[model samples]
Target: MIKVSEALAIVAENSSNMPVQRIPVRKALGYILAETLYSPIDMPPFRQSAMDGYAFIHSEKHQYDVISTSQAGDHSNIKLNENEAVRIFTGAFVPKNADTVVMQEHVLANKDSILIAAMPPQFSNIRNKGEQIAKEEVVFEANTLITPAAIGFLACLGITEITVYKKPKVAILVTGNELVKPGKKLPKGKIYESNSVMLEAALQTIGINKTKVYKVKDNLKATKKALKGILEKYDVVLISGGISVGDYDFVKDALLANGVEELFYKINQKPGKPMFFGSKKDTLVFALPGNPASSLTNFYIYVYPAIKNRMGFSDIHLPKLVRKLNDPITNTTGKTLFLKALYDETNVTILDGQASSMLNTFAIANSLLIVPDDVEGLKKGQLVTLLPIN
Candidate 1:
């Protein structure tokens, strides 16, 4: 019965990074960079205009005449001298001997000559070459998650492709002879299978869109056969609803018989104490509790971090927010409890009917209120830790 933090450390230390794969920039969002990206060329590689103005030498005061017009992508072999200025539009390259730009509104322009109405500051409105970024600089570091902003930055550096970590394949399995699929009428004493679909959607939110789902009956032979066959095909296997102390609870025994080394079982947490974890041939397996709230909590507290670590993310925890409790709540004194909560600007209110079997509580919860194991109860207006759900 190790603490949750201790168990997390163990799992993180054991997980390995995924293999690197080359992907186009458009498809690299949410993937982790496997290699450092260096800039091949300078940003704004040449001197250009920062505004629509006249480019001229600052040393030549208000007495200057418009010599030639320069627009973007204009590589005209034009030169400037004293008392001469170029009609420069935005992003046009500054001609030689022009070190300053005067806005059109600040100057009086006639047919041939232009008069500076005000004194233009030195280097004003002139965008220098390589001012934004220098060549050969490290733009994106290795192991960084590729976000939309990161992808845009890479594209700005002319990077069309990048090396990123491959996504892990997760296999979701649901067990119960009385369980039936959704959209079909269930017989008496039967319920629609939901753990598999919920877990599949949850995994997709964490950037793992590829998953294999299997629904097995509550039988040792069928469960064992499914586990043995799928263990080799996926990096992580998630089995729901067969780890409790029932006559048909055979997940733990089957894994042991098949040579899977148990890492830990029966955590001291509420709603998910019967959860189990094990490994065999580099494939990780998690036996989640059957209840909807327990399964969701187990995924957030354990499985999510495991998958994130393998994807090259260094920080695998959700962001925490500080909030005041809106109502008092009581819990057992020896096991940590994660209560489904809804938090806004003023207060965080625990959802009613927090039992493991309640699914509606989870649907409205935007955060989880983390109650310590030794605490018995909380009072209204007391500050508590809130973990936001993505």
Candidate 2:
């Protein structure tokens, strides 16, 4: 067995990148940018009016002749002379030699001229050229995740398509003879398999879709055949059950026989110590424990980071913070423990039913309280690191 850090390092070294694809910028939200993006031209492309008012040279004059009116999209060449003003609306092009604009409310209207109620400062109501973005400026770097605001910025630059990291194709193989699908009649000594659905939901939460699920009996031949097929297709393979050292455990042997190089077999972590990770070429393989909670926990801790790194994500790990424990907790498993807990502003409350086979604690928990292997227990009000799930 390896330490949790060592297991994570191995996962980091084993991840593989999917090919980049050029996608329409409108449909690229949540995808990582594969290339650096630069603005093609100055944002706004012209000096624009920031508000509805008069456009003229700022001076001490009390009145000016109203030459013409300029609204948005009025590109007619209009130059302002001394003591002359143009009635401009919001987003309209500011006329040449116009240095200021006073609000309409600040000016008294006259038939052919306008009287200034207040003197306006120079360039007061104009959005200067390239104020938002300069031409050829690097606005977004590679590996940056595209958000709604990024889409708008790209549209302003006239960029309709962008190169982004392609999402990985995933395949899940749930192995167990006594496992039955949900909504089916449960026979004796059988439990409804949940690792597949839990894993599917976890993947989607991280913006990863395009997943397929398969089931196989606990037979070595069948497991080997299933593993081989999935390995050939999917970039990431998540297999639940048949990983521990049990009589029916056959996933490890099948993976090894199918040329999946073992990166590490076990980690010094409670709930998911039997987890196994390997890879063949650009494909990553994870053999998670059969327990529902263990599989999901391992996915969040190990699998999620690897997938994110492959998709050109820089912040691959979940956010972590230190919080005081509401109550004392003990760890007797001689491994690092991940306790399901609810976190408020200052403290975290550990929930019950933390057994690997149980999912009740996780349903209501928003964070995982980390209990290091060196610590025997934590006293009330003691600080511990926590990772949020929501």
How many clashes in each structure? 0, 0
Q: Give the TM-score of candidate 1.
A: 0.91
Candidate No. with top TM-score: 2
Give every collision pair in model 1.
none
Per-residue lDDT, model 2, residue 139, is 88
Give the C-alpha lDDT of model 1: 0.87
Residue 203's lDDT in candidate 1: 90
**Candidate 2 clashes between residue pairs 3 or more apart in a chain or in different chains:** none
What is the C-alpha lDDT profile of model 1 across 1-390, one tens digit per residue?
767766777777666788889999999988989998889988878888998989998884787988899999887777888889999999998996788998888988898888889867889998887887889988878889898998888898889999998888899989888898899988999988899888989998889987989888888998888888888788889999999999999888888877788888888777677888888877888999998889989998889989998898878877789899999978765888888899998799998878998889798799889888888999999999988885
Candidate 1 least-lDDT 10 residues: 1-10
Among the numbered candidates, top lDDT falls to 2
